[model samples]
Structures are given as structure tokens and as C-alpha cells.
Target: MSQGIEAADDLAPEIRQFHEAINSGYAAHPPQPGQTMADRRQVAERVRAPWAAGGPAMARTDELRVGPRGVRIRIHRPVLDRGLPSLLYIHGGGWMLFSLDTHDRLMREYAARAGIAVIGVDYSLSPEAKFPTALEEIVSVIDWLRQDGAGAGLDPSRIAIAGDSAGANMAVAANLLLRRQAKPLLDGMLLNYGAFDHAVTPSHQRYGGDGYMLNSAEMVVFWDAYLRGPADYEDPLAVPLRADLQGLPPAFLAIAGCDILADGNLSMAAALRAAGVPVVANLYEGASHSFLEAVSISPLADRALTESATWLARRLGRTCG
Candidate 1:
């Protein structure tokens, strides 16, 4: 291991490998000055491609256009069955980078492990889509599921939402929106190392360095790119930690102990508990942001996903395989 990886003693061996892979990928394709967003996205896709390959096989996979925005959604069903409880999964990437293709294996792992369908959304990215645009598309997908999920072999009444990082932020925000509209909320939430707020907590100082999958500086850029202006900082829908967490569904938070966002995730869990919401927070010590992507190699990542799958199965009113 290089000095950089070895110095990150807090990160698990597999997670360290994950970081190395990411760093090497980016190193091999260093960003050029004045690169377009499209260029950056291509770089991201190339870097993340290997991690998304070769996982549990699905009984069936289907693609469909959903909602007024014609948002593309990919559904992975573990077994051929009707009325399956489903998880509506949103991919992270600070609301800008990743896609359904990048999170393919992760979604399949969840579906196969939990014996449930996983619906991955290809929501619009930011800097072009802006705030509320992706959020609205997500809300639209939720609505579509309720109205037409049966046709997709999903039991709409038993659905849950899940995501990592920015995706996690939107999951909670979507629930909050449903609450405000007096609509029936989803069954549960599975939030993994979500960027809940823009606050610079102590965790940022401790783990926001370069080796971590995400850093404070990158977070600032991501938030800036996703939001329209300073006004969004004050919007509860944009910054979920600023919102009232009451009446939200039971949440299972896969908190990464060594992540820069750890403190914020902890705070979010506390807020959920204070609001009388049921919460199961499993803090994975020595893990960094995006550590779950190491499931292909890391036992820690595998254990975390297994625990989360069990929780989601129970929450969605089903039993894991």
C-alpha cells in the first residue's frame, strides 16, 4: 500500500482498496482544465464501470419511461412473482454524476438478497436540471408507482425508498414532500451516509481529507452545482436536515463512522428519533463515504448490505431469502 492508503488507518482494507481503485482511475484520466460537465461525466462513468460489473443475477430486468418528465426507470426483480414489495432506489453522485448503469450491481444485490424488486431511477442531473427538478421527477416516479406499479408486478402500498449520499437526501426530502401533500408516504427509508446538511461538522475536519471517497470541498462544489443559489441553503426540501423529520417512515441508516458526513447522519438519526420515528442506525466504524460500493470485496460492506437488506425486507413487509 502507498503512504496515502496506509495513512488512512481508519479505513478497512477493502475500503482502502476501493479508494485506491477510484484514485487510480481518476489519476489515469486526470481532469483537463476547462473540461465540460459532459467530459467530467464521461470520466466518472469510465472510473466507476468496473465496480458495477458482475453481481447476483436477476430473474428479470425491465426498463420503462415513467411520469410526465419521461424519467427512465430500471426494475430488477429477483424472482418472477406478482405483487412483490419493491424498493425505489436512487443513486448517489452528489445529485450530478452517477446513473442507473453505475449502480446496477448494487441494486441487483439488494433485490437478490432481500427477495424484493429494486427500481432504480435515472433522474435528471444538476447544473442543467437544477434543484427541485430532480426532486420533482422523483416525486413523479413515486406517484407513478402508486397508480401503475401493479402493472410492473409491484405492490405499490408496500414500497420503500432508498439511496446513498445525495440520493439519500432526496429520499427523505421526497417523504417530506409526501407528508406536506397529505399523501400516503412510503413504507420506509434506507439512507446510507447521506449529505443531509451543508453544515461543516467536526467529522468534516477529521475525515474530509483526499483519501476519503468524498471530501468537504467536493461537497461544497456538489451542493453549489445542485442548488440554484443561496436561497436553496434555507430550503428544507433542499437541505433535509433543516426540515421537521416528524411523520417520516421508519429509517435504517447505514452510517459510515469515518465519513465526513458522519456527524450530519448522526444528527439526522437523532432528529428522527426525537420526532418519534422508528430508526435503526448501524454505524460502520472505519468506513468511508461510498464504502458500500466495495461490497464485491469488503466483508464490512457485505455485512452492512445484508443487515440493510434484512431491515428493508422487514420494513417492506417481506422476509429476506
Candidate 2:
């Protein structure tokens, strides 16, 4: 009995068509040798480029330099005259793929719908730069935001960190690091199909094969490419689910029922609740990983995005039209 449930029979044809197209593409270019992670990312970017290029126009794009990494950050503001809370968004790709460009539509949609400023970080990818690099880059960006986001038309004090998959892991880890260091506090977290634990859960064991999307073997490849060594797997920064959840900010977790990572999300929510952290976990039935990206065409996708945005708006104290 999830809060938002959209029956499969009610799905739009366009959404089904979109899913078919994606599946066809995946089948045609199944993950193979010589197809490096970079190649996979390029494929995703190409598929998403057209949609991104045609998305709602933004007020402007700005780059924020933190340390030696010239982080490419984009700011999407609402059309209204009033200022609003800011969200620091991290894009998902299992830490191996995707960028701000790949997630342009979703971020812009969130910014417009939530009536808040959205800041997307183009953090360095893995296989080239491994674990701790992404973590360090995210922390630096947050620090820069806390210090200078106000000048960029964002309210620094109301900043929240958000992301999907590996990005969500980074977001939660960044918050934990900030809490540990007594740094600037975040208002909350918006986690979508987050990969909080690398250890195979029951769901992973069940859906480890293809057809469900995001196969377990592919996930392992990503994990290997991102981590420095076996020891990193146990670190809280690498696996936030293992970290102490006490005193963390409130969280909104949207997990897909058919995803291999489902159980990990459920367990994380339970752990957070047990530790006294306010959490809202919604399991969307029949949805697969990365469903949020397919929302423009899929009815279930639309419902998930709507519910997530609504939750985010409530948490940020904003009203949607």
C-alpha cells in the first residue's frame, strides 16, 4: 500500500513505446567487450541529448571552481520573482556514467516544479578517478555552496542534497561527513533508487540476471571500477548503509520494486527510522531502476516523479502550481 500507486493498465502508450525503444537499443548494443564504461556513458548521453536540448530554457548556466576540480554546475531557477530553497543535485550512473547533461531534463523539471533553485554537479567519473574522488568533489561543492551559493541566487541555509543510485550514496555520505566534521548542515535528502549497500541483498540474488535491467554483474563491474580496493567497500563513504544513521537529516527515499537494489533501500529506511531519523520510503510496484528518467513517456515514471517532487516540495516548504 504505497502512497502513490499507478496501475500498469493505466500507463500511456507513449510511455510503453519509449520503454520499447530503450529496450530495443539495449538489446542491439548489449554490454560487450571493448565497450568501456565511457562508451556506455556516451551512449546514454546521446540517447538523452535530444530531450535535454529541447527541455525548458534555463535562466543561465554557471561554473563553480572548488579546489583543482573546476566543477561544472548548472543553476535552474523558477520563473517566479521570489527566492526559494536550493537543492544540490547529483546525477546517477552507478558512479561510472552520466553527467549533468544526461540528467538535464529531470533536474530542470525538479527546479521548476519544486519552485526551488537546482544546482547540478558535474563530478568526475570513475575508472579514471576512483572512490573518494567523487566523495571529495561533492564535499567541496557543498562547501562552496554554503559559502557562495547565496550569491548565485540560492538560499544556502535551506540547501538539501539529492541524487539517484551512486549519486544518492554520495549525497548521504557527504551529509554524514559534514555532520562528523561539524560543517554546514543540510536541510534534508532526496534519495531515488539509491545504492546504499554493495553487498548482495536478497533482491540482488533474485534479479542478478538481465531482463530486469541493471544486472548484478554490471553492478559489480561498476563497483570494481569505483573502489580503490576491497577495504573501501567497508568504509561508510563507500557504503552509507553501514554508517551510523543517528542525527542525520530527514530523507525521502523512492525505490523501485523490481530493482535489485530494492531491499537495500528498504533496509536503509528501516535503519534510519530505528535511529530516530525521519524517513519517507515509497516502493513503486512494477517499476525498474532508472524509471525516473523515463517519466516523460511512462505513466508510472510520471507518477514517481510527481510523488518525489511533491515530497521534496513539502520538505522544502514550497507549493507547486
Candidate 3:
């Protein structure tokens, strides 16, 4: 249902180069027939290792278990200052793949740039945990933060939720649940190329293929794995586009122009604005999904990250000095 864009170069030069690097890594480690999920994760780790390396270091870093489920969380603090604002960052791997390690550098970057503590959550994966499981764990993390964050050196009242792809979906879903339950809501949301709806659109038809990094067929597989059945298609928690967008906090959506989920991300921004929530939707032209992972090489990625860090600082009441 989203309109199509026409451009000579589908992706920017740097983004295209980033794709080449990732594609080459996959080509080097071709998938075996009938490979298990563990094996697939191994391949992904190896492919993504280069991108996750060497970013700004944190003044203090710690790993601890939180919530009743004891969800693993890695906290990166830019400084040892107590009561610092926090960003509860959920990593995106379609609820199936990747981990905290895959996104360590990005978390560090945010912490350094925004001068805030970045908490990376290691939520349960899908097909094994299924829908609502990961969502619940995320909500549990939020609850834990609000209740016990000051002990952990964070200002719980200034917390924000952030993620990309499926993680972004869960971020919004968790906030929606909190709002519905009359619980204290997060101060803001930083969503990067989020998959808000399951519906296919013209963008999916155009850019979902080998070069795009995420294809339509792979999305189907991910959706099938995360969801229980047809019933989940109507559930707002599973597909946030179906939810009542009112009463959520200010949001910043980093939309990748050349990605399959572009349309859905755009739709989400529109919905948030319609609900009277302050929204800043930034569309990066010629960018692909997961382009933020290429911050080391892509200027576009760097610019986006800098902009997002600035926005997060403003929304969370921090001065980006």
C-alpha cells in the first residue's frame, strides 16, 4: 500500500559497498543444507563480526541479569556519573537471529554520542519462544529498569526504548502494553527501519531481493517463525500498525529508503503524528536495511547515527555537549 520511488542507483555508494562486504562474508560461508538454528547463528556471527568491532569505548561496562526471567543485559555507561539517563536498546534480528554482541558497537556509539547509559537486552528468540514471549521479556526489562535502575546508576524516569527491525517492533509493542496497563511509559522511542505491519507493499516488490539485504521471502519465514498462527495477524502487539497509537511518547524513526520495510516505517510515523505524539521521521535516501551497522564506512550511516543520538539526548533531557 506504499508508494514506490524511482532512482538510478538503488543504494548509495557507501551502502552498496557495505552490502558487498556482508554478501561476500555470506558467500565465503555458504549455508549447508538442513542447517540448524545454532549453525545459522554461527554463520551470522562470523559474517557480522567485522562490522561490530572497534567503536567508542565506555567509561563503565557491566553485564547483569534483570527481570524475573533474568534476561541478560549489557550496560554501557559513557561516564561513571550516577543517575544518568538510559536507553533500553533491543537488538534486531527478526526475533530469531543475532545477539547483544552483534550490536555492541552500535550501543557503545549511542552511549558515547548521547552521553547516556545504553542497556542492551538479550531477549528470548522465536519459533522456540514465539510471539508475546519476547514482548513480555522486554516489558519485564522495562519494569525492572523503572523499579531498580537507580541502584544500577540510571535515572529510570528518563528512560527511552530503541531498536531496529523486529526489536523496534517489540519496543513499540512493549510501550503500548505499558500505556494500556496504566504503567509509567518510556520517555521516547528510537526506531530504525522498523517492521510495523506484515502487509506486503510496492516497496517490498521492488527492493526485496539479494542486493537489498532483506527480501520478501525471508520476511515470510521470519514472520512464520515469530507468530503462532493466523490469529496473530490481527494482534496489535504482534503487528503494531494495528494498535491504537495514542498516548505513546515522542518518537524518532530512522527510515531506510531502499529497504523492504520502508513503507511500513513511513506508515508508523504517520500514525504516531495522527495520534498527536511528537514524531521525527528521517528517511535516508539510497540506504538499505541495517545500514547503521556500516557506520565505520558509510557517511550516510554516520550521519544517521549522529542525528539519532542528538534526538535521543533532546528527548531524554540530556545536553549533547
Candidate 4:
């Protein structure tokens, strides 16, 4: 083992505390069983209540029509008074949980550090809304950003797309969809520990059991709840690792070393490079899935976010003070 990984391995105490906090938070109010789609929607809405209350409030929050769904979005403007690049961010919850509110703190930090406008998309959740629903909502939000974000003091042409975990999957898919249509292009993409395939990789098999966090069984449960049927697993939008990655925007991908999804993220980065895309991939030693959310407290999380924002700022051609 390298020194970096070895050092990260020694941070077990902190990682354990982080895990306990997250598990306790979720255990307090687990998702209720849903007998119908409407019931599931109700459950999802209730699950989001805590997230809505957890983070700092953005400069502006509003509801906008993204196709047929009324998508909720929060805009965190740059702390400095100037025109800034915009980011359309998607939150991670394995597709079944989480929303803009859950990721508000991270988004605020990005906006403050990167000097960019951060737009958090409250895309539809799974089981109730299912595969294409979230994708469609995300794409529609991108389209809306291209149209209205400029008037909101952003440079639409300098917009980038970003997300964590399942949201990262949606980000890649939305980018691909836009490319296919030859429509508005994104300046770049940031994918953080996203799951790109339903097919099990070595990491999944190796870490299928507990102790690593995000076990294969939990992944299976999340996938089954998010996808409509078995056939949807083959869809590129659902499993972006299965898609052709050519002609996409430059990408910055971050993977947690101990995450079950680690191999999948590495493979996606390799594939994108093979397809001639500029890709910068980072593997944070000793980190588990969803470590970015701990940035408000963890030193390692703070460092990772700082590096991520620096990469993003470079791609967007903006300098941060």
C-alpha cells in the first residue's frame, strides 16, 4: 500500500464517526412502505423534509416548469459582485432519496469558493417517478438554465453540469442527450462517485458485505427501486457506463478509494478518455461514498471540495481569490 492510502487508512476513527452520524440520521425516520405510486411520492416528499431544514438557505429559491413536472431549484449566487459561470447541480440519494435541500451546504461552499452561480435541481425521485422521469427533469432544467440563467446574472454559455452518485449518472446522461440533439453545450462536467453500471464489478463483489459502507445489497435495493424494470438497466441513461462516451464535454471525476462504486467510476473515466474526451480523475484515499457531504466538518472533505472547485474554476476560465 502507498503512503497516501496508508495515511487515509489511519483515519478510521473519523470515518466511523461520520458513518454513525449518517446512519443515525437516516434511522430516525426510515422510508415508509408504499402501496401505490402516490403513496411513494408522499413518502419521498416527507423524506426530503429534513434535508430542506439541514442546510443554509440559498439567495433565491423557486419552482419552475421543466416539461410537465414542476421542478424546484435553488440558486446560490457568487459572494462577489460579478458575472460568474453557472453550474446545474444534481444531488445524490441513490436516485430514491435526497434533493436540493440535502446538498445545500456543499453547493453554497462551491458558489462561495468558485465564484460561480450554483443551481441545485430537485429532480424527481425513483420508483414513483422512475428512470426516464429524473433524466427528463434534469435535461429540462439544463434547457431552462440555457434560456433563463443568463438573466439571473449568469453566463449561460459558461455553464457546467455536475452531480454526485446517482445525480452524476443523471448529469452524464443529460450531457449525452444534449450532444445527441446537437443543442446547447456544457463547459464541463463534474461526476462524483457515481454509479454507472448495474453489472457488478470487482469492487462490488469485493465489498458486497458491510464495513465498507454502501454494500451491494443496499445498492441492489436502491437500483430495484429506481429502475422501472430489468430492461431499463441496459439503457444508457440509466447505466451511463454502458453508453458510448465519445464527443462529450471535458470531465472531472472523483472516486472514493474504498467505495464499491470505485471501480465503476475508474472504468467510466478510462472509457471517456479512450473515446477522446479530456478527463481528470481523482481517487481520494480512504474516502467512502458521499464524503463530499461531510465537507462542513471533515478536513479531508474540505480538501477534496477545494480541489474539485479549483478544477471546476480552471475549466470555466474563472480565477478565485
Best by lDDT: 1
Candidate 1 regions exceeding 4 Å error are: 1-7
lDDT pick, better of 2 and 3:
3
Model 4: how large is the Cα RMSD against the reference? Answer: 4.9
Better of 3 and 4 by lDDT: 3
Can you give the TM-score per candidate against the true fold? 0.97, 0.89, 0.96, 0.86
Q: After superposition, how far is residue 122 of candidate 3 from its true place, in Å?
A: 0.1
What overall lDDT, based on C-alpha atoms, would model 1 receive against the true structure?
A: 0.90
Residue 31 CA displacement from its true place in model 3, Å: 1.5
Candidate 3 residues lying further than 4 Å off, grouped into runs, are 1-8
Candidate 3 global CA lDDT score: 0.89
lDDT of each candidate versus the true structure: 0.90, 0.78, 0.89, 0.75
The prediction achieving the highest TM-score against the true structure is 1
lDDT of 1 at 206: 91
Per model, state how many residue pairs clash: 0, 1, 0, 0
Q: For candidate 4, lDDT tens digit of each residue in 250-284?
A: 99998887788989999999999999999999998
Local accuracy of candidate 1 as per-residue lDDT tens digits, 166-255: 999999999988888889999999999998999999999998776678878888889999999999999999999999888899999999
Candidate number that wins on lDDT, 1 or 3 = 1
Q: Candidate 2 residues 1-321, lDDT tens each?
A: 001112233224444354455556545556678887677877777765654554456665555565356677877776544456888899988788878987888888787777788889888888899989988888888888777766766676788889998889998999888877888668889999888988888889765564555678878888898999989999997899999989889999999887789999999999999999999999987777777777666678777777878888888888963
